[model samples]
Target: MARSYEANLETSDELAAVNEMLSAIGESPVNTIEGDSNADVANCRRILNAVNTEVQSMGWTFNIEEDAILTPDVFSKLIIWLPDYLSVKAPSGTTVYVNRGGYLYDRNAKTDEFTQPVTVSLIRLKGFEEMPTQFRTYIIAKAARRFNIRFFGAAEIEASLQLEEQDAWARVQEFELEYGAFNMLDGDAWVAGRLTR
Candidate 1:
């Protein structure tokens, strides 16, 4: 006999976040974005996008590596093709330099010749769905707080929402610390060290 297990699929990250925001203000969850009569789904999506942008700006350990061909010329600089590239990590076997524009330059100007593509590791901002649970909670709290402010426009509610947002962010920080996530300073140093050399 073969053993079998059942798995339950949950709502999508966007729907969950929107529902979380709705539940925060004592509203019922909806089945679909378009079917949500109580909330503006488009506006919720915009809020979620904003929250993702803000959270990503804070920097996290989310990253990916890719091989990119260096644009070899007299300038000795290489431009990364990844549009979402945030910062570059130290690559193997060679000293690479990265600029604010995500361009990589060989530290040794004489070694500009590249016969093959070089692998570059980068720290990039994750999409909303790619965020960890704690980060998603933080995003929901922030989105809720913003939604409350926009929908209610009541000073008392604003104060409470602010507190909720703060608490949510605190939880996210705690989770990050618990999981040994990268600190902003550490990431900065890693990049800065390579750039200076």
Candidate 2:
């Protein structure tokens, strides 16, 4: 016999996040994007895009796995253009190195005859539905702050939203630290380790 259980999941979508931002700014919630000519909806969409961009720039723990075929050539460089590729987390094996420009470098110095698929894990922006509760809240606060500054131009509201944004960011930092998503070491740390030994 197969075991069965009921699960209660809290899921959010793009419209939900948008509505959250709108509600934060004292606006009514929108049902759908279709046939909606409200400026608030447009602004919400723009803010959502900006929020995703900002979050991706921060490089969170959310990632997607992809494979790119290494083009065998004289230079032994592979051009990988994965959709929405932010940064390569790691390659499948130790033989490959991700260059500064997101290109793959074959450390083994393979010749032009080497043609194989390289598996890569990369950091990417999560879809609205996939975002965690903390991230959604952060996006709402950040979007509201941006929207308020651009349209309302009220100092008092802007200040309040700024504080909200700061608090949301602090929560993001805490979550990242707890989940090991924050990178604590850099190149200098490697040099320091060598000196201590």
Best by TM-score: 2
Tens-digit lDDT track of model 2 for 55-101: 76566755444453334344654454434555553354445444535
- For candidate 2, the C-alpha RMSD (Å) to the true structure equals 8.3
| lDDT per residue as tens, model 1, 48-162 | 6777666765656443444433443445444543445555544553555555344454565534344445566555656665667778778778888888777766677678778
In order of appearance, the predictions have TM-scores of 0.59, 0.66
Which residue ranges in model 1 land beyond 4 Å of their true spot? 1-11, 34-39, 63-80, 86-121, 181-197
- Candidate 2's clash total is 0
**CA lDDT, every prediction?**
0.62, 0.63
Candidate 1 versus the native: TM-score? 0.59
- Locate the minimum summed-lDDT window of 10 residues in model 1: 2-11
Superpose all Cα atoms of candidate 1 onto the true structure and report the RMSD in Å to 1 decimal.
9.2
lDDT minimum window of 10 residues, candidate 2: 2-11
Clashes of 1: 0
